[model samples]
Target: MRPNHSPEYVQSDNSLDVAPPYFFPNVDVQGFVIEADLKAVQKYCDDFLNLGTREERGFEYRAVPAWPFAQLLFLHYPVMISAAPDVVKGGNGRDSENPIPSSNPDFIVPMADRGTTSQNEVFAAIPVMRYGVGPKGLLVESELEWILPFIVVDQPWSCVCGREMLGLGKMMSRIDIGPGYLPGSFLGEVHMPGWDGNSPEMQHDLPFLYVQTGPALPTFRATEPLKSLATAFQAKPVRWALEKIAGLSNFVDDASLGLVPTTMQTVALKQYRDAVDPECAVYQALVGCRSKYSEISNLDFYDERDIWVMFNYVGSFREAVDVILGDELKKPLVVYPELDKTVSITGRMAKVVGAFKFSANVDFDDMRVLHEFDIRKDRKEGGHGQVLKRGSSDLTARWFRPLKGFFGPRPMP
Candidate 1:
């Protein structure tokens, strides 16, 4: 039998610099697991993830909400490269330009070089609900898949490739990770393009997110009694490793080491708006992406410390923050004095559940189109608007109608 080898999509013309199979070698990553509002996550799944599959296409991708938690990843790549099909197809000849220039829309910014270094990224991953559209539209429960609801990068190449190639919705932003205002603590902040409280255009300078971890604690000291006690409840490996490593018992119980070189199945909503019709999308679908990490080293887990996370609600980022942390009970952190009184900065801060840091080689590949939205014709015919319409009375108002004589206004008596 002959093996099949063909590029899925070729760089026929002056397209993007790289296609698929993005490689980020020796990536330094800081991961934080945050306790999220389940209701908000469910609503996010319904509106963002399930909108294309269930509402638009009339298929269901329900939110499982098994775990009410979200992942905040801060990645710094020492060297980043991708598989360039254009160069492979003999487009970069001796006479051809060394780095082909991409002239696209205003939003599509081309990267200077295909293989670049010092690329930084910060993203939020939410637990995707379990739903499957199998053969003949059969529903099947699948394993947990995560969705990148919010992500920002410092490189234009990363932004372009992420959005155009993988539907990652990567936005260009400035990220800072280092010593925080607190003594001996770590801080990570993202200042992306957003609008002021009242502005027509988006201001390119505004801090939208901030993550501060508690003071650094030693590995052995932090994990000793915690890991020893946790062995009784769960994480049986801790007890086993402790038993085996008699002399090195104190250091063997690092539970965070088990997560090194992780593999994550991520999903994104890929959509392109119609150039002519602003209300319609020419193409929209859910894209499934897989990222594999290997050659892991220097893994540090900080489960003992707490993470302080704040999401600033500015411009388009408000909806993204609302999806993860519901606006049920939020306390104001930063407030400015207005004309009459003080106004809090519109945002929410989440209590950190756990955090960890690691370095590894990351590979991004395996793109799959899970489900596509309905076509224009199908949408107009089969969508909810075309179905039967119904109305309901306000029950609360109706119940108070009879009490108008006693409690309600009777000629202002």
Candidate 2:
């Protein structure tokens, strides 16, 4: 992956050089540990707690990856500094083989303005780099040179082939949060203090590490029923009023659709929680009916044009149920879907829904499950597996694992 910022406007499509979100490379129980391994997770989190900001710019810790790694710049020498937050992998930068020198070195995918397909923006293949040693290799070393007290960092990066990525620098830190974006200020050309208007060659240096903080939007990823379930808990009086109208036949039957309490740390809405436990209510209604989605979106995409965005805001439960249950549960609903990252909320079960067992449903046609993780204690242990009976919104029942995952997937090396 490359740093999300650019040296100049013509050089990259990055208008938002804001700090990269620390949440890149998201991790979950059955997912890969982004960048460093488990050891790094605790270390990085601890670093922010102990030495991070509120004092000077240093290790800033946040619930998501958007603020710290993506924003703060790290200094190395007197001439250059590192790019905060790196961009998703792909895209041959201007200096790189954009309209690649070619498979034939002359075969360019012309742009429409330049007389070619509009969607066919010529791009060369970007080489993928792996850490090599860790479970999934992470960046271990790189330099950030200080160009001045306030200007942006300027330098190049060297790839495994010894070819220099002219404008690229080493990514000091890389990570992904559950589902959050970093501020735009950290990634753009840094504000170089004391930078002469037309100076030729000048430089300065200062202490490196920096940190910042912001609110943590902690939410979970569930199907339409799950979110609709969360909605059911919006207002106590409304919920209570609806329940009376719901009656026995009206409720959706599932194993447990209630609030996955473990998922609520920084619940975005207190009013919803205080009013109802839609998570539990919804889960129970959907029990035996369907629990999760069918096929899951593959989290890893090797290019900028493709991605596995997280679906955090599963539609509202109360509204859905209101429609399913009747006029008694009338309430306005909102759609809350996350546009990035993967997430898992433990203790996932529906109260009034159906009483079903969780199971891993892999297919002989797809071996990705085995390739992604090792099999361990089945769904019984509650490791990483599918809870049977996916909802209508969840793709199809086919989107589950055939076998349970005892541990998370290790990131790419």
Task: Give the top-scoring candidate (TM-score).
Answer: 1
Model 2 per-residue lDDT tens digits across residues 256-316: 1321101101100001111243322111110011112212211111111111211111222
Q: What is the lDDT of residue 171 in candidate 1?
A: 92
Q: Number of the top candidate by lDDT? A: 1
- The digit string of per-residue lDDT tens for model 1 on 1-413 reads 11143343444335644667777788888877777787887776677666633423434544555667777888888888764333333332323553333432222222324446567899888766544345423323244567777889998877888888788889999998877665545778888877765667746687788787665444324544554221232234543453344223124324333222266667777888777666666676777777876666554455434566777765667777877777665666453212122444554677666666656788888676666655453443335443222211111122343664685456532
Error (Å) of candidate 2 at residue 291 is 23
Worst 10 residues of 1 by lDDT: 389-398
- Candidate 2 wrongly placed segments (more than 4 Å): 1-42, 46-52, 57-413
CA-lDDT, candidates in order = 0.61, 0.20
